[model samples]
Target: MMNMAQARPIAPNSPSQKQKLPAPRRGLHLSPHMVDVAVQVAVVAALAGIWEFGARFGALNPFLLPPLSVVLGRIWEDLIAGTVPVDLGLTLYRALLGFAIGAVIGIPAGILMARSNVVRWFLDPLVSIGFPMPKIAFLPIFILWFDIYDTSKIIMVAFSCFFPIVAATYAGCSSLDKWPIWSARSFGAGERELLWEVYLPMAMPQILTGLQVALPVGMITTIVTEMLMGGRGVGGAMIMAGRFADSVGVFAGIVQIIILGFVVVKSVEMIRRRILIWHPESRR
Candidate 1:
């Protein structure tokens, strides 16, 4: 009924903008993550403060509780003089070498077991028999065979790290969504194409998680080997400190190992976040 001059233009999307893109609602944000971080910081600060006071006033025995200051001072001294770096570098080298060896054997073994029922049948018994046994139980035999050298240490670590990787990878691949395989095959996808597109992508999260599970074990294996083998490491340092009854060194070594484990775990988590950015929890 309106004339042409009275016609109006349609506004560009204001109602849809409000309705479709509602404001980010807020409520009880029970972020366990932030709470966990806060609690850790608070506890650590409290303990440090307590240690500092107890040490200064002689309330805690200096021999048994050497305090944060002493431990930090010793660590700082070693850090500055390059001793800690050298020892830590050697430890890192051993850990990496062992992890690499384990991965070399584990990935293919896992893939084979996953794809072939016959291979899984043959290997399941062997994996079950060996997986639960502590790898350190072989330390004496390893020493006798490999003569307390880096080879034995590396193998021990590799052995400890291997089973978890294989198990997780096998689980991942075996349980992969079957639809992808069927869809790819219907399209005449080759074996390699199916593996690349369907198998690997689906299994990657589990594989990375397996690496996470194995990494700390690798670190511990190397340190334990160092302790038993009398070579240089924080573990060896702990042993040496205990023998000399040096509480400072013993606690310092323990703290050092704890820090190393924390760092390694954090690194793994960072890698997981970066690589598996599409994971559900990660998206949240």
Candidate 2:
């Protein structure tokens, strides 16, 4: 029972008594994804504006470089007529099919190479020599063997995609630490269990990276084969446009290819992020 004069008043700024400022008002915050989108949009818009201005002012040659509006109009007409969609579907199918084939073959071969001395010895020399050879140089032989058709083109794409995937997957598999294998084996895990639960998961990130590397190669191979073989795709359209000197058609094909490549790469990145959600780097 202290008297009034002896009682100490509460200090407003004392540690436990202090008031919280409302988290410094984090208003109008832009996340990293927002920033990336904004930057990409700005860059693309700026480039398009420059191209349009140059074309309109005759600073750029209309024959080689059609105006953006003309290109867009051609693309719109093709889209409305449904020609572009068919060609797009064919191109996408070939690229994806080839990529799937490449991945199926490459991942297993790479894993085998990493795990088995016999496989590594048998494959090492061939992989070393073939990887550096320009894959496009083999196109004529493939065309002759498979007959200037979808088969040849798809095989070309697969051939172009395989080496990088194999290399990356092998590297990933070989880099794995041994402690996990020992632990799993000590716990009576079989070879299949170790591979499925430990090795594959550990190698997945690099395998996905290999797929990323392979995908663009597949797309490029498809387009090149279409051009060479005079077939149904944007590349074929470009070749025909070149013969007729239709700048608008050629530019439209170019624009379509740009859009396609961007979409494919972004989709792959999205998938990679989704699959890597368990990784600490992906959490950031």
Among the numbered candidates, top lDDT falls to 2
lDDT of 1 by residue, 237-279 (tens): 7788788988887887777888888888998899889987877
Candidate whose TM-score is highest: 2
lDDT (CA) for every model shown?
0.86, 0.91
Score every model by TM-score: 0.84, 0.93
| Sequence-dependent TM-score of model 1 | 0.84
RMSD of 2: 2.5
Q: Tens digit of lDDT per residue, candidate 2, span 51-148?
A: 88899899998777878988999999999999999989999999999999999999999999999999999988888998888899999899788887
Per candidate, the number of residue pairs that clash is 0, 0
Residue 41 miss distance in model 1 (angstroms): 1.8
Clashing pairs in 2: none
